[model samples]
Target: MHLELAVATDLPALHSLVESAYRGDSARAGWTHEADLLGGQRTDLAALQIMLDDPAQRVLVLRDGDRLDACVALANRGNGTVYVGMVTVAPRLQARGLGRLMLSASEEQAVRLFGATRIEMTVISQRTELIAWYERRGYRLSGERRPFPADDPRFGLPRRDDLEFTVLEKPL
Candidate 1:
């Protein structure tokens, strides 16, 4: 597989890959599926388009031949730290180390583009398995919590009322 920075022109494929990786029936094939907790699309094309157009943010794509296999979004937070999110590997490709590759590439970009040493991400607190995955990747809990936007359909329709985010950080 090859890894590279994503361009605005990649929006459509990226959107489909992301949706399939996190939501819908396709996501259920992977351990990372949020289908049980959220019922709608995790993201939309407009939001992705904005991220692509933002000079301070970058979205990286990993491809296996012509197939888009994984992606992540890194945003410069302007404080020597980068915020990482929207990490998604093709559902069928999960647990095969592609996610790790995309993550490592994001961190390298953080260091190279912004001279950042710290990278932060927020995971839904209820996602124990996902949190553990990040822990194994060198991230530690920050003891910070943010209320998950209940009414934000852009994120997804929450399955439970208690959904919230737990912040995690890693130093590169």
Candidate 2:
């Protein structure tokens, strides 16, 4: 696999890959599915375009030649930290080390390109296994929690009212 910065033309494939990894029945093929907790599209082209237009942000893609297999969004926070979000791996390829490799690539990019000293991300609080996986990679809970955006349809409609995100951080 090779890592590259995603351009605007990659939006459609990126949107589809992320949706398949986390939404609806298709996501059930992988352990990362969030279909039970939320409903609706994982992302849309407009939102992705906004990120692509931002100079402080980069969408890092892992590809096998022209095939986009995984991706993550990195944003330089203007501090010493970079915010990592929207991590996704093709559902069929989950748990096979691709996600880890993508995340590591994001962190490397953070330090090398942004001069970042730390990397941070928010994960759904209910995803214990996912949180543990981050823990194993040196991320620790920072005791911060933010309520899930139930009001935002773009983020998906919550089935339960209890959903929230826990901030996780790691020094680069």
Q: What lDDT, from 0 to 1, does candidate 1 have?
A: 0.92
Q: TM-score of predicted model 1?
A: 0.97
Q: How far is 46's C-alpha from truth in model 1 (Å)?
A: 0.4
> On residues 65-136, what C-alpha lDDT tens digit does candidate 1 reach at each position?
777889999999988999999999998889999888888899999999888989999999999999999999
Candidate 1's displacement at residue 65, Å, is: 3.0
Superposing every Cα of model 2 onto the true structure, what RMSD results? Answer: 0.8
The weakest ten consecutive residues by lDDT in model 1 span 1-10
List the candidate 2 regions with Cα displacement exceeding 4 Å: none
Provide TM-scores for the models.
0.97, 0.97
* Cα error of candidate 2 at position 32, Å: 1.1
Residue 5 shift from truth in candidate 2, angstroms: 0.6
lDDT (Cα) of model 2: 0.91
**Alpha carbon lDDT at 56, candidate 1:** 93
In the range 1-172, model 2's lDDT, one tens digit per residue, is 7889999888888999889998999999999889989999778999899999998899999888878999999999978999999889998999899889988999999998899999999999999999999999899999999889889999998989999999999998
**Which residue pairs come into collision in candidate 2?**
none
